[model samples]
Target: MKVTTTLIAAALACGASFAEAQAVQYAGGKTTFDGKCVVCHQAGGKGMDGLAPPLVEYPGKYAGTDEGRRHLGHTVLYGMFGPIKVKDKSYNFKMPSFASMSDAEIAEVLNYVVFDLNAQHGSAKPFDAEQIKALRASPVDGSAVHAQRESVVKSLGL
Candidate 1:
């Protein structure tokens, strides 16, 4: 009876730890977004008109593809500037680099954006910290990042 009770208690503790981890993932993501991105993207990632483009669509779609996933890592690590079209709208703005953030933070925030905010990501796996870490070896300014974005968008047909 004592052995059975101990096993049950261990199982319960593991379940609680799993739940807490899940909660922390989203909560950290939300905190990161709110503190860093919400000012430009606004609540729910709606974005500002003629300012920052809405993140609700393309980012989720980007998460779905391999190159697109890399693009997300590049954009965040390097930042982006210049004019880009999203849907039927155009945005010519400079997005500052978030290179200061840790790899895990980048992954978590992107997972929040791609999974929680945008519903179109489909079966895309959550952004992993290694991906962000790999991109960190080469650093580029926001303008170069924007130029690369043009290529990425064209290739992806976004």
Candidate 2:
């Protein structure tokens, strides 16, 4: 009985620790976004008027789909270039890759963008490091990533 009780206590403690870690990570993600992505995406994720496309809407909506989720990971990992339209506006800019960041950091930043900034509570499951890892395993360039985006947008009929 004592052994069982000890095991239960240990499990609970571990659970609590995990929760706390996640909270910290979420905050860190926001910080990372502010420090790294804000230059072009802006404070509230509103990209430059015509220079950089706003990251406000599409990111969350993209997270809602399977391919879109992959796209998000790929975009961050490989970077994106060329012209793309968002909110009925055209943006022809190059988004440099952030492949240097760890998978966890990438996941956290996207989570911040999808949940905090966009408030996309109804979006698909939050991205995990494993997903980022898988995408990173098969590398692609920014232009190809942009081409994939076209397909994703078309499939969503957006």
Relative to the true structure, how large is the alpha-carbon lDDT of every model?
Answer: 0.85, 0.87
Top candidate (lDDT): 2
Cα lDDT of candidate 2 equals: 0.87
Q: Please give, for residues 1-158, the per-residue lDDT of candidate 1 as tens digits.
A: 99999999999999998985575446688889999999999977899999998989888888877878877888888888888899899998788889999999999999988887886887689887888888898777787777777777888787
Q: What are the runs in model 2 whose C-alpha is more than 4 Å off? A: 1-25
lDDT of 2 by residue, 1-158 (tens): 99999999999999997985575436878889989999998877889977788877778788888889889899999999999998689999899999999999999999888877775546467888999999998999999999999988888787
User: Which candidate achieves the best TM-score against the true structure?
Assistant: 2
Task: State the RMSD for candidate 1.
Answer: 8.3
Candidate 1 has an lDDT of 0.85
